[model samples]
Target: MATPTITLVTAVPNPATFGQSVTLTATVIPLGAGTPTGTVTFTITGGPILTGTLSGGTTSVVASGLSAGVHPVVATYSGDNNFLSSTGSTVIAVVHASTTTSVVSTPDPSTLGAPVTFTATVTPVAPGAGAPTGTMTFVIGGSGGGLFTQPVTAGVATLTLSTLGIGTHPVVAIYSGDASFLPSSGTDTHTVIPAS
Candidate 1:
């Protein structure tokens, strides 16, 4: 007859940020005697399925790219010849990372009909790593100016314009955050003078 066995599972960094790596461990214990040997399969809800080989009744796997929410995890131990199979479960929570946006314009005070380039940069707050991806919206001169959208590449977005009447214009750069980062915006002002 096969010996009865029990499995237990745990997650390191229980509350993790989206796209952050997490370690999952599983331990299998035999009811009677002797250590349980074999492999353990981990099934993560909304994540990937991983297999780990047991060493001294314990095994671990590293996973990442989980969305911002609670995810269920299951560990199934493939019992050895003398032990019976067992399963264990756990949960992990992932939160969105905060971000900041800054905007700058080349030649802030420029002459009318002169080319002006506006650049926006997006960066993660503290305790977060990796570049943020998404779209950036450029709002020129409040509501009467114009609105333009550009894709964020390497955490930076830029726009250029040359048709400004002759006055001070307020410029805003809004970042449309992705699955891992939160949205943010930055503002600046540009003064346009009459051509010589």
Candidate 2:
């Protein structure tokens, strides 16, 4: 019996920024053994799952809408009675200067089922020394999703929407960028009223 080694199979981009998905993937290689027989379980010690799977000593998952912070991961494998657990975790930091972040949404109701102008206005932050800048994506209805990677000028980023379905449609604006520069930070929710 030898130490079971597990490697991260998931690619970590940045977990600190808002709307940034956290995916953890890893491959397990059982040393000094024949045909690894056991169940490999993946668990986010303190985060959410975005997308992933566990099978034949492989695990993966994605975490979404998670606040900025250091998140730990744990992978455990059971062997007979004595559980062989591996403690290999990563850190997830949410970028933000202050504890409270200001976010405003401006959803246009004129162009329902069509492209409309979507705006996300993030008010002056507490630590206003540096403002969050980068890509702010807009997803409307259930199918129409758009991208706006313009810098945040005057605390505003206008996202363009192509089309939205009828009825009350919910819209979300997520700010993504270099999380290391600024931890998990983003704006509030925006809504769109379908055409009558």
Candidate 3:
């Protein structure tokens, strides 16, 4: 009897987002010349046990609805008459997807050169998942469009602009995203009027 070596192959985007589907393929190779034909069982830590039939010494399965964290996966080969069983393991890191980000500018209609405060509020798709921690990129539109990065605190980021020209300015705030959340953005318009 020959020894069967099992290899596990994980799909791309290993640091997958929550609710995303991840595929795992296993290949069985026999030490001897004959091919290994049998069933492969896959087990995920804190997840489920799946089985796949090997055709040409290979089989695969998809995993979904995984929480945000590192998941340990193992593939075991059921040896046939000519081969001995073996197992391989790998780890997958899953993250959360951005839900929504809303931006609002105070003093929407204000005098030119007056300080205007912009606030960004970010919300995660899954409340129990975790809080989002990152920076927010603020981009202003118009003749005097400018951009700057502000660190988020408790899912909120703030920026103040005082050199805005007298016109309609479009403002946008983008969340740079962190390990648990994906990037997200929001937009709002600020109007500056001539000072009397």
User: Cα RMSDs of all predictions?
Assistant: 2.7, 14.7, 7.6
Residues 1-196, candidate 2: write the lDDT tens digits: 3455544444366534544665666665655453344454555645643333436656666665555466666655444332244534455655543322234444444446555665665543342234455555554445454444556554456755555554454555655543323423444444445556
Give one digit per residue, the lDDT tens place, for model 3 in 30-90.
7667678889888888677888898888898887767778899889888888888888888
The TM-score values for the models, in the order shown, are 0.83, 0.39, 0.55
Best by TM-score: 1
> What's the residue-level lDDT of 67 in candidate 2?
50
Candidate numbers sorted by TM-score from highest down: 1, 3, 2
| Error of model 2, residue 167, in angstroms | 41
Model 1 collision count: 0
lDDT value, residue 160 of candidate 3: 90
List model 1 lDDT by residue over 61-130, tens digit each. Answer: 9988788899999999988898999999999998888889999988878888889899999988865657
Models sorted by lDDT, best on top: 1, 3, 2
Better of 1 and 3 by TM-score: 1
Model 1 TM-score, all chains together: 0.83
Q: Candidate 2: deviation at residue 163, Å?
A: 38
Q: How accurate is candidate 1 locally (lDDT)?
A: 0.90
